[model samples]
Target: MKVVPSRSSEWVGPVTSQKRASAIIEIDRVSQVFQTSARKDHLALSNISLTIEEGAFVSILGPSGCGKSTLLYIVGGFVSPTSGAAKIKGQAITGPGPDRGPVFQEFALFPWKTVLGNVMYGPRQQGVRAAEAEAQSRALIEMVGLKGYESFYPKELSGGMKQRVALARTLAYHPEVLLMDEPFGALDAHTRTRLQNDLLNIWERDRKTVLFVTHSVDEAVFLSDKVVMMSKSPGCIREVIDIDLPRPRRRNELLLDPRYQKYIVNIERMFDESDEAGAPS
Candidate 1:
């Protein structure tokens, strides 16, 4: 078994590691305010600034309604921030582009399309030749462990299988950053764990920059290079902890590792503290 040192600290700004990679996504003092049905402005995120390095897997962990998904949406260019800005590779994000791909909790697969057809959609829309698109899609489907299920429709597959196809579809476009918003939240515990392991396997192959949002502390620590903790509703960064676990992490090994256990305990402690501090006196 391999061991690596872990560090925890209050996140003030960009990580100051000696080997800090270039920032692929920059969220500068971004804040989002939405007008609720009651006609009052509700602050979803408040002055949230974050920097995600290229090819890094970072997870945003927070309590429910902490604006984790809102922050992700800003980076994905799906929703504009009420204030501040989000940039990709130093360019302001005005709208959705191929550089960012999102996989949501909902399978979001086309019911009419087969697994192969769904995966091939992105490349096809990008104008790749049909033969080439099909070839690429087939490879992706296989890579996601859905090899023989190529012709199956979304309705015919299980929850885990549908999520695999959704992931393959996103990967087909060759996006630089993968913005996953609770992609496995809808599945059963067993299936979620399987997909989580599969996701890491596929991610290890390319190391694409990934921003994952999850409520699970263990899941965050298990999959991320760094876990960003956020405050309750009207979210703000509370801390950013570096997870220095060894690569090709096996769940069984990590479950028993002291360092891995420490990470989870410390994070859960922080959340408990946050909750206590927010409680009404």
Candidate 2:
């Protein structure tokens, strides 16, 4: 894996902040191996290490089959790494917990539930009172632009609307970290762009540590504080590119900006180079 030089000297890998506790998520030498009956063994990740600071938005950028979703699932505690650890707030993640909320590509809202009920699900499950859960869910629903549609069922909503509900549901319980595996991947181009802006706006308000996994370089550059590139197959951090663009990023404005184009091109070049290097003679 290629190690990119730090853009800011003060921002070292381990000492990203003046205080060690500032690191909200720590992924140390994480590796995942699948031992299926059909295959002898498949190593999906190899020595993947990353440290994300508090309130920072980071993206894991790679081609398909690079274990991007696998890494995200590992951090979310849905899947355990073969030999390494994923920690948040100094505690090892052994299994799925409310502390880390996950938003998957498939909006996994219960079909029988209304939008309000779906958002309230997590908080209520955690033992919050009915009134309190509804209040929390209502606020999140509004934040994700689904305020008046609280009565609508998942079956009645569009893909974008469902994704909004999914996001609100994930954010209802105030998680310290958000793990999203291509949450907007299936949406149409226009809807995807709108949701991206909405997500950033929500992130600005909430300021949670977000780890987003996407294959699009443009999406990563537009949303991330840093774009972490991964190698093919046994995925590892190939490079970490710093995005120097200002926040409150808009799609049209950034799409026109030269710097944004440069970052996107640079990342694309890195992936192209990696693919060429990995190709057989």
Name the best candidate (by TM-score). Answer: 1
- lDDT, candidate 1, equals 0.90
Error at 192, model 2, angstroms: 0.4
List the pairs of residues colliding in candidate 2.
Answer: none
TM-score for each candidate, following the candidate numbering: 0.94, 0.92
Off by over 4 Å in 2: 1-19
Total backbone clashes of candidate 1, pairs 3 or more residues apart or in separate chains = 0
Per residue, candidate 2 scores C-alpha lDDT tens digits across 1-281 of 11122566333133233335577888899999987699778889999888887888889999988999999999999999999999988899999999999998998889899999999999999999999999989988988888799999999999999999999999988788899999999999999999999999888775788899999889999998888888877888888776777767877899899988888887788788988999999
Instruction: Report the alpha-carbon TM-score of model 1 versus the true structure.
Output: 0.94
lDDT per residue as tens, model 1, 1-281:
11123443432234543332478888899999999999999899999878788888999999889999999999999999999999998999999998999999997999999999999999999999999999999999999999999999999999999999999999999999999999999999999999999999999888899999999999999999889999976788898888878888999999999988988998999899999999999
Alpha-carbon RMSD of each model: 3.2, 3.8
Instruction: Give the residue spans of candidate 1 off by over 4 A.
Output: 1-21
